[model samples]
Target: MLIKSLPSTWDVEITQAVNGKEALDAYRAGKADVMFLDLTMPVMDGYEVLENIQKEGLNSFVIVVSADIQPLAQERVKKLGAMAFIKKPVNPDLIESALKQYGIAL
Candidate 1:
């Protein structure tokens, strides 16, 4: 769904990770410039991933996409250095707007 949400105007290569661990590994490998992360997953959760990223001083544009819409969750991710927190069941329009708002272009 996220792949479909991306704007047609921008060209990008998409890599899908099954879980947070895989996502973090891909990021470490320099495959992820922009990551759309879920808060829940097997192996490792989104919060841990964010913490690891912060701890390692890695740089990436992280936009957290999750069903957990609690204000605390949003605030936590923000404090952990996520650029944005997007609600689950993502809308294409919102994805586009977020990208533009964060200066994430091709």
Candidate 2:
């Protein structure tokens, strides 16, 4: 539903993963340019995914989108190298801003 709401002008690709492990596997398979990650996902979670990505030196921008708005969680994701931290029920403007920060335009 969210992907459908994105502007058509944006040249983007969408891939769905049921959990972090699948996300990581897709990442390894060259399935994405930028990733929107949910921090509380089952079967590995976002932080573990970020760590694995970093350890493998994957070159992709990751933005953490989660309901966990705790400051410590935000800081932890930042330390793990997430490019942005967006709370759940995300606003389009915030998504736009995050894309712009990474020099991606719609």
Candidate 3:
């Protein structure tokens, strides 16, 4: 749903993973520039994925879009190295802003 919300003008490629482990695997295999992560997946979960990414020192920017809207959850992901935390039913404006911060022109 969030991916569909990206503007038609944004020429970005997107990949999807059903669980945290696959997300990590795809991140490594795809050379993804950005990731839209969910916190509550089976197998590894978003926190573990963030940890692994940090351990790998990967440059992919992460924008966590989860239903866990608590301030603590937001802070935790940020501390764990997510670039930004936006609530579920993600705002396209926020997504654009996050990308822009990473110097992604749109």
Q: Which model scores highest in TM-score?
A: 1
Q: What range of 10 consecutive residues in model 2 has the weakest lDDT sum?
A: 1-10
Candidate 2: how large is its RMSD?
1.3
Better of 1 and 2 by lDDT: 1
For candidate 3, the per-residue lDDT at 70 reads 88
The window of 10 residues in a row where model 3 has the poorest summed lDDT is: 4-13
TM-score of candidate 2 against the unseen true structure: 0.92
Looking at model 3, residue 39 earns an lDDT score of: 97
| Cα lDDT, model 3, residue 73 | 93
Which prediction has the highest lDDT against the true structure? 1
User: Can you list the residue pairs that collide in candidate 2?
Assistant: none
How accurate locally, in lDDT, is each candidate? 0.91, 0.87, 0.88
Sort the predicted structures by TM-score, highest score first. 1, 2, 3
| Residue-wise C-alpha lDDT for candidate 1, range 15-95, written one tens digit per residue | 999999999999999998899989999999999999999999999689999999899999999999998888988887888
Once fitted onto the true fold, the runs of candidate 1 whose alpha carbons sit more than 4 angstroms away are: none
- Scored by lDDT, model 1 comes in at 0.91
lDDT comparison, 1 vs 3, better candidate: 1
